[model samples]
Target chain A: MKKLSKRIIVGVLTLMLLCSSLFIPTAKASVPYDSYTYNFWLDPVESPNPYVPKDEFTGDPTTMGKFNNPQDLFITKDGIIYVADTDNNRIVFLDTSFQYIGEITTFHNGDTFNKPQGIFVTEGNHIFVADTENQRIVEFDENKQFVREILRPETELITDNTSFRPTKVVIDGAGRIYTLAIGINSGIVELNPDGTFQGFTGASEVNINPISYVWRRYFATDEQKKRMELIIPTEYNNLFLDNEEFIYVTMGNVDVKDYGIDVIRRLNPSGINVIRDFGYGSPIGDYFVRDQQDITRFNDITVTDYQVYTALDGVNGKLFTYDYDGNLLYVFGSNGARQGNFKNAVSVEQYQGTLYVLDNGNNSITSFELTEYGSLVNNAIKLHYEGKYEESAENWQQVLKFNANSDMAYIGLGKVYLRNGEYKKAMDYFKLANNRKYYSKAFTFYRRQFLGDNFGLIMTSVVIIIICILGLRVYLKTKKINVQKREVNGI
Target chain B: MSTYISTLRYSLYVIFHPFDGFWDLKREKRGSLSAALTITGILILTYVIRRQYTAFLFNTNDIKELNLILEIISVLLPFLLWCISNWCLTTLADGEGTFKDIVIATSYSLTPLVIINLPLIPLSYLFNLEEASMYYFFLTLSIIWTVGLMIFSTMITHQYTMKKTLLTIVGILIGMAVMIFIGLLFTSIIQQIIGFFYIIYKEIVFRF
Candidate 1:
């Protein structure tokens, strides 16, 4: 009896241990995890910020905070989330933790939203909504009270029959409002805060083919010119205001032949692109993607306080992040139906170290928190852009230890070597990263070194060739004189 | 077959000794029209294959998006137009070379391009990013050789002085431009006429 009891007790202990081992792993797996599709770097899971609809959206449409096809999300400094509940005709407000705070459903004198597609909450807590279908902008105060409505300004600069349907709006620090209205290929329509009309800003420059340019200038009659398509600027897709109040715009319809122009632009106050390129190639999209349709079409952009901004690529449903100098830091998110993937990534916003991407296809927001490697990449890129080359190189090297295929890390190391004047090493790294600009610069230095090393041999050969040429000329002249003397003596 | 082979082989010698090669190619009928056309075809084939199979580092064309027929037309149209335009202008300048001679000389001039470019296409595959300059050097060398042969053949075939040959070549370029302008005008006029009839037909049908 004593042996039987001991055996039973041992068996029960073994069973308990097995059950605990199995249950612990499942519990760990159930915890929110970060997952992102990688092109060049392996971004492991840190944590996931999975969100469900608030209590108002749980059941029926009788609640104030319910969202219907929310198209955009903007987070303020204090972490208030402003969502453009597009189909619901409201802007649902949420606190830092995504709890339903309140919403703006109606405006002045019983007017309400006519599909507000964009929402921007300024530092002073003023709300600006692109009341798109209604052809007006609704602004409200911090107290959730209706302030004033700004209609589309009638200006002489606006060509005849220009559509006033605004889709996105942004305000600069100087209280200048820029609107990207539909069918306005001219550019972003600028307006004063007091609703006065200003001119367009940062219009896409017209590209004229040289052959057709000559034909149009010299051959086409005035009547033929009238029938010709006006070489207007491409339309602006979206805009974001950076910490410096500089406007960053994304043009989705950039053609293939505009060699010098990028689809992404950081415009200064004077409407000039001021973003510098430091080893990072044009931060528009994947530069080497083979498919023409795979080119990134940025629908919206979110510029963070860290000077690292992200653009939401609608075509691929991906998020591409770049630093202030337009160096690509990381590319993550994708088009799919999984936990972190988005079907239609319409807008991306950064708040408190997490990215909240609003998906229009599924009408939900998927948030991505930075893993350890993600934070390391961000810190490395920030240091590199801050001109701390050596320190950033160390971080970039660490990143390479984790993900050897990190092209951005290779670029970082290339820039470091370039700054240190190690041209050969810089050229190797730049070639690996496929950066032609820096590669040529390094090639120039290498060429100088090669020429310096071979200067003696080159000069000797050149002198020998010159001497041989002169000797041949003299020999030919004497031979001719001999022939002439022979002829005269025979005569 | 032997004659064709000899004429094509003579093109190689023509590149080196252009004065006599082009004179015999026209006056002695050493180079035939079929041989010249074959050379033209080979040149076009080299261009198309080079674009298609050159190493990615040295190539910028998207191969998946390449339309073979359009690429061929884009090359052949300009080349044939240049030949025609040059022949027309040379005739007006009282050149001795016939239309066949001009065609044969122009096509034969492209032999150097084919000879250098065809070998370099495969050789490009062996090049690293840093060694791309070697490939580009051969490319530039071939272009210079072909242009030199073209000028030489033009001078010899037409029996013109160097200055007159240069002037006639410039005139040929101007004549090409004029041809292109007239072609575009004709296309536009044809399109407008078709559009007018289509509109009238639509109106008549809709009113009834």
Candidate 2:
């Protein structure tokens, strides 16, 4: 009996150990970026020199050849960086290695820049600078030769009375120049390729207040009505051209309560927004913030491809990166004095795998290199979009081993299973990702399979249910008749 | 205990035979005020719990910012107001039902809804995204059953025809609205009066 009890105890101890093992959480796999505090922190690459190259005129005696409140940076396809040196009134140029190439302080035709805040370079190396203080956009050819200066046109189409102070510029494929000027609520100032004023496009709709509207219509005097502010669109903060020439514009000052207007918009040729809202909640920065001032005043947007874009918010000094479907992938860069943080992040641009953020307060550009996990995610997304689902499935599974909380990995697996016609497995993965549309597609295929297999059983159950319902109804009717008959007999 | 159990059991019978069940509940003294209040309390608990515990896939409630007191008041106040408004209107219309009858009948009519919905809170957890239709169907079924039961009880309690019962139900809804408006106006006036006293008190303190 003692031996028997000893055997039972051994068995119970083994079972307990197995159950405890199941309860223990799995340790997350090591990711290169796992050491960073932010959700998608890119490691700052050690630059040979962080300052923009200066050949002739060094900056203030203490700061040396460093920048002076540079407001924007745009990297061309050939890996050339152009900096809008706003305070110094020059457009500085740099090579891929962060070494200064040259500076454009004056035009060939004797027109010098005055506080140029925005710069854009086309594929053919045509440069466009928004000379903000000069109140005109100066264009330069690939050889740094002055092409022309575009002034605000006088046309019946221009409606806003705001002064023409162009702060940003983006040229579309159709040779349309979309400019963001100070106090311009009409829309992005669209000028024809030859600098003729094109009517406003992508004008934000004015929010109507129902209570104030009724009062104003019924009670306000004519003089009071005249004094009332004209309902106009909010000014566009910045604009960028995507790979397809679609303009992505950001608005800095927007009412938090207005759900209709998004902080970021990708406008089509006709100026209608085409970005998909993935319902991952707000597609902007942090939704639940401690203070209203913490809200992001998005100043610049940089599109790597159609699939990914990053917005640099000046207010909170945060960088919010989103996928094509409007899923916020990463949020980093807090407003702080830390090395990786930005004091006043104004613009972000990408050259190859490096992201350079321009900070106005620091007067410096910071470069961040992609970690291993970032590369893995990018490769998997690229492969999946390229229709190599099976290859991408392996990468997604590897991602899950690192971060089980990744909803995109689950979506990738769902897509793989869907392509392989494994509807049931696809449904499970899509359900995990909370993707209702894909889940419904999988359910339709699963239902067809289920019904095909159990056609006989389903028909039998349906017939049986009908008969049972009818029988129950008839039985209840007879029982009622008998009870009524008994009551009549008693009376 | 037996009387309470029987009163609760009679709710099931009343749901199927609302006309006779409501009449007997009033004329035969079959229902008790305690039992009616218990049913109403259960209804409120069911609503609150359902909003909290429903599966995330089907639950649209912003659980992060949920206010328990506000949720309870939203459900309970409307119900109590409806009962009071219906009773007042019926009294003027020469309806046979008393205040107790109206409250009891209304509470009893909610049995079908509570019965269907209480079980669904747990069952929703078992359903996947595709099987969510089952949960939705039961939700809609409970609402329809309660509405049908309410109309039937109202018709029987007042001894009115179908048309008159519908019209009276509409009038009861309007009366509930008017009561709410008056309550809001009274509260606003009280707030203004308090504000006036507060200003005078501040003036006295500052001047000294």
Candidate 3:
């Protein structure tokens, strides 16, 4: 009886231990979507998730009502979140903790918004709403009081048949407002501080291939010519102003071959494109596509203070983040019916390393917090940009521990090694990263070192070879003379 | 064995002095068929080595996607096509070179490619991107020299004038293209026939 009781107790204890172990959570749970970045070969390589969904804001209907087809999201410097509830015809505000601060349903003199699509908040807390259907831009003060409304410009450039429906709006640091309207292919419409019309700026140039041009000019019949697509500039879908007041615009409907040109542009005050693309691949979102519909259609773009911008693709529901040099840092997100996945992601905004994507189809704001791997990469890039190579190297090493396939980390370490006069190590890292430019720079130094080390041996070999050749020639000449003398004497 | 070595060394002389070398390569039988084939094999080996061993700064080939058989075929196919096309055109143009003569002359013309590029494989490592133009200049020079040798070999081996040789070379290129087109069409037709038989077999098996 004693043996039986002991056996029962031991079995029960073992079962309990097994159950407890099962309840313990794993170190990293699987996410609903995969994160990837393009390799040097333009192939999509899987990477660790940079940002994962932390929380979502669906809003209570009893209080501010549910978010109805929200079109835009803007996070201000004060950690406030503004959502343009397009179908609700209102703008909802929330604090960083997602607490309801207030709502803006009406402005000056009984005026209201109609399908407002875009919202921008300045440093002074003033709000600029692109009241899309109302054909005007309404401005509100920091206290939520209506300051003024800028109507459509009554200029001859905008013909009478053109309907002015501004879809996106941005205000520069100098108080100049730029709005992207429907059917305005000329360029972004610029408005003065006091609501005066300025000329269009940064108009996309029409690009027609030579073969098509010759065919259309010479071989096409009248009906065929009429059926051909007209060569015209595409309209900008959304625009954002960075800290330096440069307007960053995104065009959704652009030709795949015209990716680097009109798909995304950073326009200076004078409307010149100053975007740099020193990266391996063009900043065209996706390099490999199977079909025409697989091309990335950029819906919105958000720029951070570090010049690291993330463009949101409405089609794939992915966010492509790139550095100032247009090198793609990471890509994440997808279109699915999951908690983290978006259905129709319209806008993306970054605040304090967190990304908030507004999904029109889901009618919610999904907030993503940076993972450990993500924070490491971001810190490394920031440190490198700030000229702190040593600190960046440490961060890059940490990042490599998480993702060994990260070429960015490899290149980061290569730059540091090159700076530290470690040419051989730098060359190895650059070769692994497939960065030929930096590899050449390191090879030059490596070659110089090799030649310097073997200089004495090389000189000695040259002298010895020359002396051997001379001795051989003298010996052969004497033997030839002896043979000639023997032949003459015998004759 | 001595004859083989002598004929093999004759390629070095042929590349430099095409007019006399090609004349003797056929008339005096200084060059042999085995020697010509050996040169072709070496040229193929040179291509493979250059593709794999050239410095990363100058080599643009994706190493992961490198196919050894494709590299061999890239050299061998064009070489054989040139030989066959030249033989066919020369026969019709009242030229004197036979198929063997065309093969020997064409293979001798390729000696410069092997001579220049085999050393370039290692020399590529010694230069930087800033001095890439120097490397490219030598590469271009080797190609031009080989092409010039090929033109001269054709004229001498076939005993034709410069104009006729140039015209015959143009015809050979067009002939190569036509041959490739016909080869593709033939294979595609064969595939369709096999597919038809496969479907018929499946239908018969299913019915039974």
Model 1 chain A: weakest 10-residue lDDT segment is A50-59
- The candidate maximizing TM-score is 3
lDDT of 2 at A473: 99
Supply the global lDDT for candidate 3.
Answer: 0.90
Which residue runs of candidate 1 sit more than 4 Å off their true CA positions? A1-65, A106-112, A133-135, A154-165, A183-185, A204-234, A252-262, A272-296, A305-308, A323-330, A447-491, B1-17, B20-142, B150-208
What order do candidates take by TM-score, descending? 3, 2, 1
| Candidate 2 residue runs with Cα over 4 Å from true position | A1-64, A159-163, A222-230, A454-491, B1-21, B28-57, B60-103, B114-141, B151-208
> What TM-score does chain B get in every candidate?
0.97, 0.96, 0.97
What ranking of all candidate models by lDDT puts the best one first?
Answer: 3, 2, 1
**Which scores greater on TM-score, model 1 or model 3?**
3
The candidate scoring highest on lDDT is 3
Q: Give all TM-scores, in the order shown.
A: 0.59, 0.74, 0.93
Model 1, span A17-66: residue lDDT tens: 99888766443253232333223222222222122111112112454534
lDDT per model, in order?
Answer: 0.78, 0.78, 0.90
Count of backbone clashes, every candidate in sequence? 0, 0, 0
Q: Report the C-alpha lDDT of model 3 over B1-208, residue by residue, as the tens digit.
A: 9999999999999887888898999999999999999989999999999999999999877898999999999999999898998888899999899998899989988999999999999999999999999999989989999999999989999899999999999999999999999999999999999999999999999999
